[model samples]
Structure formats: C-alpha cells, structure tokens
Target: MSNQLFIPPNYKPVLNTTRTEKAIKLTKDLFENQLSAELRLRRVTAPLFVLKGTGINDDLNGTERPVSFPIKCMQETRAEIVHSLAKWKRWNLKKLQITEGFGLYTDMNAIRPDEDLDNIHSLYVDQWDWERVITPEERNLKFLKRVVRKIYSVMKRTEYLLYEEYPELVPQLPDNITFIQAQDLQDQYPGLNSKEKEDRAAKEFGAIFVIGIGGALANGEKHDGRAPDYDDWTTPSEGNYKGLNGDIVVWNNVLQRSFELSSMGIRVDAPALLKQLAIANSEDRAKLMWHQMLLNGELPQTIGGGIGQSRLCMFFLRKAHIGEVQSSIWPESVIEVCEKNNIPLF
Candidate 1:
C-alpha cells in the first residue's frame, strides 16, 4: 500500500504550528522521563544502521526489506537500516551488564519505505525503543501485565500533565485499561475480521491490552503478525492463558478508530527461540551471530518494546494525518487532501 490518506469533513488542527511544536516537546520530555522512571530504564545511544547479515536487525514481520547501502569506507561492507532495536537491545543488555531491574531506552529512527502513508502511518518511523533485564522469575504473564499497567499509568499521567498545561487539550485515555485474550475477542465477534474485532473492543473499553499476538487464534489465524524471536507469543502461562505479550491500543475519537500505541512482550528465551525460529521456518537464523548468542544463553532475559513517538504525538494533538506530526515525504494526492482540509504537514 502506497498511501491511505483520509481527512474528516470540516477538520482542523487543534494546535497551530507554534503550539504543536511546544506540545510535541512537552510530550516527548514528560513521557520519556515518566517511562524511564516507571521502568527503571536509562537512555542509551542507538544505531541508525547496523552491519548486514549478522541477525542484529529486526525483520519486523519477516518480509519488509530494509533500506541498505554498501559502505565504501568499510571495505564495501553492506549496512542495513534498523527496522527496530528489538534484537540489538538484548545484546546491549548483555554487553552493558545491566542490573536485573535496570535497562536501556533510546530514540530509534528508521525509514520504512514500504509503509502505507495513511492517517496514522508514515515512511519515517520514530519510537522509544526500550529493554530491561529481568530475573527468570519475572518472565511470566503476571509480570508482563504489571509492566503494561505501569506503562499505561505513565501514559495516563502524561496525558493529565498535557491537559493541565494546555487547557484546550482534553484527555482521550481512560483511567483504567481492559485486558482480553485474542481468542476471546475472536469468539466475541466470530463474524468480524481481526481489525474489526480490535476496533469494536477498543471502542467499548476505551483502552485495552489485546494479548496473544504472532500466534494462531482459535480460528487458526493469527490476530496479527509479530516477529517470533523477540516476543514469546507461543508460550503458555501458568494457567489457561497464553502469550506474555500484547499490544496497547486506545480508541481514537478524532479518527473514530482503534489506535495502537505499543507492542511489548517478554523476550524469548533459548528454548522459546529455537521453537519460534523453527515455526517461522527460518532455522538458519540460528547460525547468525546474535542468534548464536541467544541460543548459547549469552544474552540477558529481558522484556522490551517500542512506543511510536510520532503516532503518540499525533494522537495527543488530535491531528487527522500523521504527516501533520512528523516531517516526511508524502504523495501529491495526500498533500492536496491535507491542504484542502487545512492540515499543515510539518
């Protein structure tokens, strides 16, 4: 998909350029500080591109090709733009010798050339990629839920602060979040598709954590595609529940749709890694440097995920188009539509 631009009738930005700039800075600063304190994370430097074929780059859903180039200065070694810092963060946790409760976070920027340029999607991706080392006992469904709750709480606090600062802005998040399993949602709306189910649930709950991604539901179809190596989506919890990972989504009143804010989970261990790699039919990945280290128990047991920076800004600012929040190349058609609707793309 190239572009999927949409502008509501009589749409206008809540904040003008000057106010939007101020709000964006406040959002980033407050959210980063709150998230780091809540998760016990320290900010770290991240790479824009990494050496190719080392299995350090995130494959995403395992199909999207990364932007790559040959480095002449480095003897023609190929370098690939990072899809995400998923795998690299684990390596960092190990190398940095981070404590069990401490982790790292960074401002990750990437170019998703194939991203659908829609109201919420963009080619230029920016996110707060974070990872934290955890004890083996902390690698459970309960722990995952606790972390999700903490992150959600911080998000709500950030929203409150923003609202206090800019009285014109209103809070769109709920005080509490609802949790549901993927299979339960499928059962609730057997006739609807996965996305439709998400929309319905998010709309009703105001905020939700839809658990069990990257694995098949009761209908033998996955709710969404997730990279197997990073999240333990196939593992079963202590009881009947499955998957220690899920997505944080909220209803977008402006777009009148479900909006995803984050995808997080417990990192895959050695056993889970082998199982997931085989399920993905990419067992050859085990031979790669990062994969080898994981299989050998050289990496730390961690939980991490990326929170979309621009998407959050767009949501908070109630902008109809993602281009309004981030400066990125857009199709001429999209430009025309935004201009017609009085949306100023940054």
Candidate 2:
C-alpha cells in the first residue's frame, strides 16, 4: 500500500517557500546547538560511505539492501553508502579519545535506493547521527531513559523557538513526553496491529516514547524491527521492559497520523553483540574488522541515535508531505495525487 497523506481542511502554510527555507535553517541551527550542548557533543565531518566488508555500516532492520558501488581507483574495492553511522561513531569515539562524558555529532547524508517513495519515506536520508562516550556503569535502562528525556527536552525547546519565530505556526508538541513499553501497548490494544497501536498511543499522548522495541513481545511479534549490531534490543530493561532502544513518535496534526522523528538507544556490548548476531543468524559478521574490535573490547561504551532533519522540519512546520521540506524525487502517480490535493512538493 502507498503511504497515506491528509491535508487538514482550510489549511495554509505558516510560511511560504522563501520563509520556509529560513525556518528550516533556524530549526537546524537551534536544535543542533541545543542537542549538542545538552549532550556535550562536538560537531564533526562524516563519511558518505565506507568499505563493504568493514561492518561499520548500519544494517537497518537487517533486510534493506544498501546502495553500493565499486571504487575504480581503489582496485575494485566496493563502498556501500551507510544507512546510519551507529557503529562508526563508537569506533570514532575510541579513536578520538573522547573521554567518558563528551561525544560527537555529524551531519550524515545517505541514499537509500530501496526506500518507498511516500510522504515520509524518501530515497534521500539526512540526519544528525550522534554518539556519546559513557562508562560501563551507565548502560542501564535508567541512563537510557535519562538520555531520551534530554533529547526530548531539546526537541521541545526547538518547538517553542520555532513557534516564537513563526507566530503563524501553532505549536503541536506537548510540554512533556509520555513513556510506555511496547508490550504494554500491545496488551492494551490486543486486537490492533503494531502500527495501529502506535497511532493510538500518539493520538492519546500527543508525544510519546515507545520503549522495549526490536524484540519479541508477549504476542511473539516485535513492536518494531531493530538492527542486532547497534541497539541492544534483546536485553531486558527492569522487569517486563524489553529494549533500551525506542523511537520518538508524535501525532502529526496535518497528516493526522503517527510520525517518527528519531530512533536511539545504547550501543551493544560484546555479550549483547554475540547474542544478537547469533539470533540474527549472521555470526560470520563477527569476523568483520569493526565487530572484531567490538568483541575484543576496543570500542567505547556509548549511546547514539539519528534525528531526521527533513522529518523534523516537516513536523514542526506542519507540512503535509516531506518534499515540502527537502528536495527529492517523487513518482508520477504520487506527484499527480499531491498536485491534485494542493500539496506542495519541492
């Protein structure tokens, strides 16, 4: 099924194209400054792709094929565009000798060719991928929740500043974030599917952090699929809590649906890595250079995640389609539908 789109009746953009560009820049700058300062992170440059066999690339959901090509100048060695820098950040943390408190954030650009063309899903992905060095004692659920709250606080701050700058834009985000485990959501709505459950929660809560994702719930199904190598999804979190990783979802008033803005969690350690790799049936990946370093205790204990740049712009700006915030290709059918509905597509 194609991704759904809905434009509220009597809706109009708070800012036109030129003002939209200005708003996007302001949002990026304010959020990055807030997030980096809140997390003690420094900005850095990042690679667009890496060597194929390095195991540094994010294997999102363990199924999506990466966009890869042979480097002619490198004697046919292949390079794969990263889906995310979940692993590379940890290695870089170690390389840079970033102490136990500081971290690094970078603007990561990627091409996900297999992505579905829709209001939310796009072939081009731009995000702020960040990682922070932490002590081994800080890998527990409490620490994860604390970090999540910090990130959410930055988001809320950005929302306020955005509304202040563009008075015509009404603030949609709540002052606080609601936290719930994925299993609890499933239990609450036994008849509904996972996406439905998320939508229901977002509608009810306005802003929510669905915890315990990536692993099997009581129903023998995952709330959502997460990669085994980066996030410690299988690890238990204080009683029934399943994953330390979760997505930040909010109810989009314009689209009238659940919208995901970020995915973050603590990085996997040696034991978690081994167990996850075994469960994924990809133990051969353990021999990869990055995995070997991880298994050998060379990388630092860290927490990291990606915040979608255009997605944030779309949400805070109250746009119906993602193309209104970022430039990317759309199918003829999609273009026709969007045009017919008076949806703006850049």
Candidate 3:
C-alpha cells in the first residue's frame, strides 16, 4: 500500500452509496446557487480544451504537464486539455464584457495524469472555477479577505442546508475563519514542514486561510507552489507578506487531517505579472499571446479561484476516500485496501 494512503481506524461512511449519490446532487445544487448569489457570478459554458501556444492553460505549481493531443481537423492543430480556466476566464471577462463586481463561474473538469494518486488526489479533477472583475484600487489584502469571508459564508450555509436534507451528517465548520500568513505560521511551528503547519493550524482554528503562497518565506522556502502567470504571488501586501494568493484549509474530522478546498487570489496586473515571471525565472512567458494581452492592458483586473467539487462533497459526507464521491481509476492495491476496509469506491 502507498504510505500516503491513510485509512482512519474504524472508519465508516455516514451515507451509503445510494444515499450519498442523492446528497452529492443536493450538495452541488445548494453550494452552486449559494456561491453564485454570494459572489454575483453567472453560470457560463467553458471549453474542454484550447489551442496550444495561446498560454491559456494553467501551469499549476509551474510543473505538472497538461494532457495534450492534436486535432484531426485543421491540419492537426495541437490542443491541450485546460488545466483550469484561470487565464481563459479573465480573457472572457473582456470578451463577455463582465463589469466590475460581477463574475463568471463554470464547471471545470480536468485530468492531471501526473498527479500522485492518494485518498484525496485523483487523475480526474473537477472544480467550480470562478473569476470576477475588480477595479485596480481593490487589489489589496483587505479586498481579498472580504471575498474569502463571503465564500466561507457560502460554505457554512451549504453545510447547514446539507444537514437539513440529511440529518445523519452534522455541520462541523466554525462560525468564522481564521487568517494567517505563511511567515507567521512558520514562526509558530518552526520545526514542522508546510503540510504539518497546515495540520496544526486547521486543528486549532477549524478553518484557516494561509496567505502569501507562491513566494519564498523567511526560511527561504515556500509554503506552497503557485503558478506565476495567474495569481499575483509577488505583490507586496499587508505587513511583510509578498503574495496576495492563499489556500482555504479546514480540519477534516473524518480524515483527521487538514483538508484544502480552494486556492484563490487576485489576478496579476502588468507590473505584478512581470515581477512574478522574473522571480520564477520564466520571463520568456511574457511574450505569449495571453501574456501580451495582459501586459498591454487588454484584460480586466480580477480575483478568481477553483473550489474542489469532490473534495467538498467528500468532506461534507464524511467519506474517508474521495473515490466514494467521484468516479476515478484507482490502483489495484488501493482498491483492495478500500474494499477490505469497507470503503466504497465509485
């Protein structure tokens, strides 16, 4: 068995597979409507793939290779399955003329072939990818916190609705979320690794927003990796923070670990983009078409993020394995282990 797979001792699912399916639908509907209403987002159709070389695909963590193939038509033009709509949404904000304070949301599906499969990580990824237009003046930490609170409120509401529908599943989220910077978290737990720090914070606070990701911390290491093109990770924010992006992590009672639900931040302006690109040693990306558009001020200032759909469902339903909620291929050993443990895999 993979050492990463941790099956909670004496684990049992709250909802059976049949009932879990129904709850999944309800969970998605409740969360989607609440999130759209909370964020002023409109549901929109999104592409499964984009023409390669446009620089529209998100290079998550500046690593993982995208699943790409060539089209049979149009002289075999190469196309890449979108990693996420991070860049495409901003471009669409301009194409669709999305005004400030309004945004777009889509059901984003992706395949991360290189993902290290575990209980949480899967090759088939699904999320609610959302982006919103913002004014240049509203690109600081305060604005970011306000948006985070709004999203967390939606989460709390969704959990309440879930409880109303399924009495077996009780809501466990706290009334409010705590915010902390990567530097402070590092200082608090000087001996722990990034994941360990997150576990400690989540256990203490129930929920936390780990700010200042994608940049070097005081220890000369990053709390996490973020692609430079989409999020403004090098921007000077409150205090000694160097990034405007962060992740939402909550303590998972079922899994007994910190569970990350979303990664979000304000999109980069021309200066921030250039600075991040230079810092990442990826200055050549500035010449891409999408980069050129942003550099030339053709895209809107925006804040956007991807919230894991299956991750939320798994957490809400108290499923020990993510595959219980989402359909995906699992290794033989994992399947055997889950089966032996009475953990259903869809």
Candidate 4:
C-alpha cells in the first residue's frame, strides 16, 4: 500500500484563516440536511458504549475489535466502544418501529486497529450510519439506482452551495452519478490493482456507485472485503451461488479528483446470512447470544452502511491531509514532514 500513488511529497499544506472553518461547517451542515432529505432520515440517540461479551458490537472486516475498558468497580465485565452501528441500526429500526422508506442516522465514532492511517485514513473514526427497510419487490437494481440518484442530488446541491458560499471551491460534479459493477471495472482495467481501479473509475465517471462487492468476482477475487453477516452474496431461497451486487455512494471526493465517500449495501437475509457466516469461518459467532437471536429470525431484514464524516469533509474541503480536519497523534516522520510543509496537524 505504501508504494501506491499516495507517497507523501515535500509539499506543505498552507492553512487559510477562514477557508478551513467555513469548509468544515458548511460541508457538515449540508451532509446532515442532504442525507435526511434523500433517505427521509431522522436524527436519533445512539450508544457511546456497549457491554462486553454482548454481540451488540461490529466486526470491522472480521479482524478489528472494539475499544474495550473495564467499568469502574464492575467485575468480569467491560464496555466496548462501537466500531460502527451496522448491526445496531437494524435492531433499532425494528425497535423504533420505523416504517419502510423511513430510517435513522446517527453520528458514529469508532477505533480501528488495523488501519494504515494517512491523508484519507485516520485512527479516530466518525461517520453517519443509516439503514432503511425494503420489500422484496424493491430490492432490485432499479430501486438501488433511484436511491443512489437521490443521494447524488443532495451531494450536488451541497456542492453548489459550497461554490456559492466559497468561490474558491470548484468541483465538476456530474448531474447524474455513474453506475458500474465491480467485475466490469476489473474487465476495463485488468492490470490495475483494486485501488487503481477505484482511482480510474472515479476519475472517469466523476461520481459513481460501484456495486457487486462482498462476493467474489468472475476472476474469483473480491474487489473489496466485507463482513458476510451484514450482506447477502447469495440470492434468497436459492441453493445456487448468489452473485454480488451492492450500491456504492461515491463522488468526486477531492476538488478536481474522484473517490469513494461511502460503501453501502443491502444486508442479507437468514439463509444467506448463515451461508456468509460459514464462508467467513465465523460460524462460532453464531453461537453467541445476539447471533442466536439473528439466527432465530429475531432480527429485522434491512440494508445499512457507514458514511465517513471526516473523509467527506477532507474530500470536499480539498485538504491534502486528514489532520487538517481533526486532531490526532502522528509518527515523528509524519510530524516533521507536516511541519516542514506548514500543514497543521490539528
């Protein structure tokens, strides 16, 4: 990954007194308003922590664990910081009695152990996670495209607003976001790596919603890794192998460049969930308390995903490094380079 296109240069990030402030404030506000309008999302309360040993936690790529700390004076128990509300949102949808087409969004913060933190990646995670129910009829490609169009509309609106308020911020966003499958991307550029494919797609399409993730592709390779329990790679009620098809929420992330802002997909139902769990070799989790409920059909059939708040901020704000938006510790080499470049770590 280090040898990829993101090698840091001897460049310094200049700080403007007002641009940073205005960019962050306006972008966040627009995100809140846009997502709500697109998905009919409502702001709601979310948990800061969850009890240890309860399956009310997220398994990020099936590798990272939640940040855990012992409750004061509590024995044999600890609370875990949420990685994301991927599972919790579905549960909440049912608990809150949310009807179809109506969903909830919450500010989610988490810690990832294995992230290679850099300009786009960060240790301190913050995102907007949302989920809504869909009937069997509404689960096809058409509905997904409609929802993606709605999301892109809000993004375009926000971009226009940003340009209106700050003339310096210029982004050439297409009125309609592009649609493509992962395998199609692979066929278009067979020699390019996964990251390279993303770069090409974003650069070519301006805005795109890549689908068919989570499941392996025609070349027997998956474009990206996703937790099996969250998505259905297999079609419902068919013993046949289910193909991968998911909706991405992406756009021109940088001022003049394109990149993904979010990767969201419709979740899997019972049998497919069980199949994915087995494939991930995480069938052991199925024995856990919460997993038992889901296995027993006690959970809702819903679609959900996370949208990175800082990533979006960084992309739209046209910042070179993620540190420009949030405060966090960096390596000595990074610090020295950042200082030389006059890039504010905060």
Give the candidate number with the greatest lDDT.
3
In model 1, what lDDT does residue 168 have?
77
Residue 112 alpha-carbon offset, candidate 3, angstroms: 0.1
Model 2, 242-298: lDDT tens digits are 687888999988877899999999889999999989988889999999999999999
Shift of residue 275 alpha carbon in model 3, Å: 0.6
- Residue-wise lDDT of candidate 4 within 243-302, one digit each (tens)? 334544444443334456776766767777788888888887778766777788777766
Whole-model lDDT for model 3 versus the true structure? Answer: 0.94
Put the candidates in TM-score order, highest first. Answer: 3, 1, 2, 4
Pairs that collide in candidate 3 are none
Put down candidate 3 lDDT per residue, 1-346, tens digits, no spaces: 4567889998888999999999999999999999999999999999999989989999998789999998898789999998999999999989999899999999999999999999899999999999999999999999999999999999999999999989988999999999999999999999999999999999999999999999999889999999989998888888777889899999999889999999999989999989989999999999999999999999999999999999999999999989999999999999999988879999
Q: Candidate 4, TM-score vs. the true structure? A: 0.89
- Model 2 stretches astray by more than 4 angstroms: 1-4, 7-11
Check candidate 2 and list the clashing pairs. none
Prediction 4 global C-alpha lDDT: 0.72
Better of 3 and 4 by TM-score: 3
Q: Give the TM-scores of the predictions, in the order they appear.
A: 0.98, 0.97, 0.99, 0.89
In Å, residue 331's CA in model 1 sits off its true spot by 0.3
Off by over 4 Å in 3: none
Model with the higher TM-score, candidate 1 or 4: 1
